[model samples]
Target: MTDFTHMELELEAILHASNDNIIVTDDKGIVLRAIKNSEEFYGEPSEKMIGKSVYELEKMNVFSPSVTRKVLEEKGEVRLLQKTASGKTVMAKGIPVFNSDQQIVRVISLSHDLTEIQQLKEEYEKLQSKVERYESEIEKLKKRETPLDELKTKSPIMRKAQETLKRVANSEATVILFGESGVGKTLFARAIHRESDRHLQPFIDVNCGAIPASLAESELFGYEAGSFTGASQKGRMGLIESADGGTLFLDEIGELSLDIQVKLLKVLQEKEITKIGAVSSRKVNFRLIAATNQDLKKKVQEGTFREDLYYRLHVIPVEIPPLRERKEDLPMLSERFLHQFNSKYGKQTTLHPETLAKCLAYSWPGNVRELENVMERLVIMSDQPVISPQLLLLDSSQTDEPQPWMGIESFDHQGKTLKEVVLEIEQNWLLRAVKEGRSTYEMAKKLGTSQPTVVRRLKQLQSDSK
Candidate 1:
């Protein structure tokens, strides 16, 4: 075969082997040859396009705004996004064949379907949107989650109170904490302030009961220079002014006199406060969190506490349950306090089960404060590594009388002999040992007997009981 014939055959073979649609057209855009891939790509047969001009094919909508037309007009390589009536898309690149005279002779157009690339791009966008949505949800959940790392609460009631505290933390609403004395109401108020938008600002804590009634007004609302005989010449900013843009935790609110209550109600209503001798009132913006152990409702009926002030401060009421009702949290609480006091006092003291049992059995009238104080005392005074029941020192009355919880169950003889009664007592003590996982030496120490004797009696008792 001649060189020209061989080249023509090689061109035909390459066009057939190509996966893309290839078309060779003259300078006027008359189709000379085309690979027959139109049926799959654009729902048109390439055989029907071989003899037609690209201008006629463009009118037939074979490929709108043809790449061949662009190459012919521009006289250079060009690319176009070619689409058909069947919604098929392809990226077509058109290159003009240059003659020896630097003139365009032919236009070679190659196109590949863009369906896969389009689908991949759409999938990437969808995945990115989902990732952003999930991140936003995770951040919201983190904000809602309890700060259990510092303040542990196992009771549902206490946890619900914490949830309420989180919900109203950012708003400028007044929160009133109702609970018995030593129920950690002050701590919850601090938590509310810590989680609020004004966390970086000051948290002014005031115990209304601790302050003397004579100076309560001047202490809360500040005083001007020479406002009183003993007042400083430079004047003073009280707790209310000092807590601007932050939180003012009024602890023991029930202790405030009726006169101070009226002034506080006016402050809550107007959002401003006046000094003792200042003519103009200064605007104050503070989040109020009041705590009281006294029954304010009864106080109001008795004409001691102001009813209007009660309603203002009672916007969000969160009651903290006393420790007695939440004894299930005792183990965690005691362990935490034990660990804390041990670290503080440079001691490695551990709480024994029997010692904890004494704590659990006692009615903690003073609540968590009492429990905390007891633990602190144990850590400081107890010399041994393990704290025993004798070292509990719970109450003076407890020392005087026998606690029923600490003693064994009382059983009737039921006409049985003394020997059977003594055997039953032994069984009760052994049962306690089993539950406690006590070693023979430990049992002997408790029983004031030898280890071998205790071991022999344990085996004999097990056989007799069976």
Candidate 2:
């Protein structure tokens, strides 16, 4: 074969091998050739498409607003979206080929089916809308007049705690909040920080129990670069250092090891922090707000916690009473949570009189956090505008009795195995526990298993449900 003919054949092979649908047209927008993929995208065979004018094709609606015509009009590269005769969407890019004279000779059109991309784009838009709505709600929540503005109460005990919080908010004295888990200790800490002079500064929270014992020190007191194996190339700033010129609220402070307790005491006393693997200490001016559900005095007596640290943190002690102790606040707290969740889920739901009565009567072991969770669940799960008392998932204020079965009943097993049935029951149990404000550690303790196992099971249950 002639060399020019061989080169032409090679070009044809290259065009055919390309994944993109390719069409080449003369400067006048008349198709000269089209690849096999053109039929898949444009619903027209290559042979039939050749020698056809793109303008004519446009008139026939073979492809709307032809990319070839666009490139010809612009005398340059053009990219556009087009709908094929079969109604499939495609993204097309047309590039003009120029000869030595700098005049347009041919136009090469490359297109890819946009059906999947369009679907993905639509899905992304929906997800983005949801994220934006959630963020807007979060911003509204943050801009509230006061963090404790939502802590509506009539109880003297809660009022006393609030009084103490307000009295010491501006003071630099270390404050310790002693309460049961879910009693809104963190909320009180945030309220204090917001009311303090450092309200404009950051409020850094560190969960001592959440971090592993091995990495607790490094996480609290950041290390320098190459301080240990697997350290970040840039030196890390510890949580304490990050809270400089702000307030550092350490939740579950009793979980800290004795060694960490000693270093923390130094920080409280000296108003400075020494990072791990560093010689010199850096001065950090931050107010400390430590909280714990455990009795630090008992922990110190048991030698699990240091006496000096206890004394240092116990300067302005605030005890937040649990929900069961202050049942008068239940109605207000429940109403607030209901409104919040209703706004979140785009629902207008209300508690039935009986449902409200049931909620008031229950001895909530999980406190305010649990009540919030229960309200959210009711908002999401209830079909009626007025939620009923029958919808209450928790047992009747009796902790000794087994939890009532709330799942769908399968009488004949429906051809399911025992394992599947057992798994469904277990998953339901775990979900209810989580909705009751039970953390992984709390769930593990109740289940007599490890925290990691509870987490894994919960994750598996979530995945299966999804």
Q: On residues 36-81, what C-alpha lDDT tens digit does candidate 1 reach at each position?
A: 6766865678788888999988898888879999998888899889
Total clashing pairs in model 2: 0
Model 1, residue 114: C-alpha shift (Å): 80
Deviating ranges (above 4 Å) for candidate 1: 1-149, 396-466
TM-score for each of the candidates: 0.55, 0.56
Against the true structure, whose TM-score is highest? 2
User: For candidate 2, what is the lDDT?
Assistant: 0.81
For candidate 2, lDDT tens digit of each residue in 1-466? 8999999999999999998889999989899989976777777888988999999988988899899999989989999999998778899999999999989999999988898889899789867965664465346438643555545575668988998888888999899999999998888888888888887666778999999999998999999988999998767879898788888999999999998999888888898888877999989999999999998889988999999889998899989999877655666777788888999999998776446545655778898889999999999999999897778888654332234545557323467698866775665565445434334666676667877886677445323422
Model 1's lDDT to the true fold? 0.78
Alpha carbon lDDT of each predicted model: 0.78, 0.81
